[model samples]
Target: MGALHLMPGTTFSNAEELGDYDPKRHASLTLRELERYIALEVVGSCHQSIHSGLGRPPIAVWREDEGEIPLRLPQDRMRFWLTFLPEEERTLRPDGIHLFGLRYWSPALSADVGRSKRRLLVKYDPRDMSRVFVRRPSGNFVEARYADVTLPSVTLREAQTARRTLLEKGRREVDMRSIIRTAMAQRELVEVAAKKTAAARHAKARGSKSKVDDGGWGSLRGVDSSKPVPFVEDAN
Candidate 1:
């Protein structure tokens, strides 16, 4: 047994040392060639030729115990894989389950009027948003179809990205509105100040004009033209 182990182990390790072990060359091999090489030249030869301590060829022993291997159907495998997908807690809204702005509903969900606003675990595929699976109270996943099928296809990734982009745009619009309001308020203040300054200047000009008009009367205060009786002549 030790002699047999030494030979096979040395052969496998030496295969990598050979020039045929180039990864690029190996990758270029077709699937048929690869499979044939693996099945015939690799462990397949060992399984068929080598005998274990049980005194039977490794492949024969494996064949005898084939029933011990678990056989899973395609649907069962899918179910098993889906069970591990990440789930989100969502509520059933009036329109249906809203995920990334898209609504999803099913006949089962629509039939239950009392389920509105109820929380459920939802699992969806990023590659396909046309349908989602909701974990029902019975601990089973129920398929939910998109409410509007006429629309373009939307993946979960696209939905999330669009939602984020819209959110950012909304926030930007809010900030712009705030800035516009502040600018408007500042403009109003400036306009009010300008009006007040203009009014003050006008009032001052009016007062100065009135004083100038009254000064003309002051020049006539000493003049008494009605009692003038003598003529005055210039004497050198």
Candidate 2:
């Protein structure tokens, strides 16, 4: 499992502004619930904007624009589309200047069954600023609009990136262990071959010495037979 920390001050926009709302009254919803709501809302909106023949409408008012609207405080938990604008382009337009599509406010904790973690996932199209997707655990999906007013202190991207990094690190660790095991097996094979060679050499030396002793005994028996034959003739 992985975790991400959402910092405050992340902002997003949508086709229409969501009216004012309070989070204190609805404290009954758990943190996971809130996260799910944001994810579903953002992803749905992005998909609609891109694929629903909407001609890529402007989702949110850019922050840098002169007439950009300020998001109301104590926001409602409504879904909205988000996009990133290059610094150069941000200064050009007010309402229709977002670069990457799909943005959403995420909570601190949520269940991500896909990755087995409570993390947020954001998918956006840089080419089409209208198509964006956000995923969370709430089971609530919002498309092409702002979520019900909810103060979001975290950005979805940060959470997703952190989770990815942790998973990659874990994989590297597993690979290292496998390499060590393979090296150890190779070393054991070398030791076994050396022991077998030493035993064969010792056996060959012993066999040679036994053959020499047998040959010496045979020579001695032949020489003694000559003396035995002379004693037999004298008796006859």
Candidate 3:
């Protein structure tokens, strides 16, 4: 199949008047906007215009033609489209699924355990790596959503980076299970540290409050520890 280049003409050309053209100037339009303008206006005009070579309007000739045109898409077009999708190979673990820094698990993947092959194919969209599709031997794609294991504050990029950094040490081949286990352990440690930091801040705040009260009481120089203290009456 040959490709046809469709371009929009801004104005009618006159060879006698070269002043109509300016070499330094070009159309100030984005590619998308230009394509839209051409499709909506220029192409429509051309379709209705009588073609000098064909002796008929392009649309009329196209409609009146009796020969068959290839309009149907191929059955394997989906597979071909999927060929461009980024592939992430992962093995299902007993605990759950983990890939691209975020942990993921589903009942379908859980059932895929003990398969004849240990490795499973995972196809993901680069635009949104939060979910992936797992392919089975039967050529069926199973949708696997992202696991909710990461903290709400953690972004998708951060999650993917965290796993990438974990897996990228010393160029040694790493097992999926071990990588996930280590990552989970590290995550737990981080959680514990975060909790400890929060608790420490709370304790410090409480201590400061106590200290302020103590300072207020201690600032009184003439307080008699042995004497019975009388409560101050409100002057209501």
Candidate 4:
């Protein structure tokens, strides 16, 4: 078992010789593919395999140890969930809570507005940028989602990329609406590009099967991409 350690966060490192899910070997490894590979590796194999130090599979050891003591659960599950998410200090303006050039608001936060000007504790999940947890003066956590509810949810990386694109286009100020539009447009182009690349690769590996999603790239078939549209310009 050489270097059989689990990777941290979003950076997953495969075993030295695993044929499947090797990023270097499988150049077209997608996010979904990584998730499926991890699910199989950890639950299907690792849980059933024997541990060198424990002398037994982890699941077996966990079951045997369960009778020793009862695990204490959190009284408030919402609070417990927010405890582990990434957090920051943010100002709660009348418009809403601002973070990463996006604005968040909640009906629960209306009562506290103008009472006092103080920075609120904010917690967010990086995977979903649709909502954030804000700690009010009363010390209770409230969900503050995007002020523009119609806007689609995007990851932190997507938002940042959109912001950078706006700056590169000579836009002095980048707003939330521009970020959303640019990110979504960029995502569409990515889907198209990925399909084009996959079609070329499929010609070579036609005999082999794949688990990647088609992701509606078929609709983009034969679409002319000679002149791609630029990112959404700041309307200021």
Best by TM-score: 4
Top candidate by lDDT = 4
Per-model TM-score, in order, reads 0.41, 0.16, 0.38, 0.71
Candidate 2 has its poorest 10 consecutive residues by lDDT at 1-10
- Model 2 misplaced stretches (Cα beyond 4 Å): 1-174, 209-236
- Per-residue lDDT of 99 in model 4: 91
- What TM-score quantifies how close candidate 1 is to the native fold? 0.41
Candidate 4 at residue 125, lDDT?
87
Candidate 4 lDDT over 1-236, as tens digits, reads: 22122221122445543323333322555566766766767766677779999999997898899899798999999999898999989878888899988899999999989887889999998778999999999999999999999999888888989999999999988889999999899988988987887787667556547433233122223435567844332254
- What's model 3's lDDT at 72? 67
- Give one digit per residue, the lDDT tens place, for model 1 in 1-236: 32222221122245544323233311223334544655554454556566657787775787788799876567666578777777788887666676656678887776554644468888887666778887765567778877765544555555555555556667533322233334345546756876776677558757774543222221123445579645222242
Task: State how far residue 111 of model 2 sits from its true place (Å).
Answer: 32
lDDT of 3 at 126: 56
Clashing pairs in 3: none
lDDT of 3 by residue, 1-236 (tens): 00111121232245553345432232234344765765655445567779899999887787777366756676877676777887877776665556665566667766666663666788876545556777765667777665653423333344555556665765255544444455556657766876776677558757773533332221223444568744332254
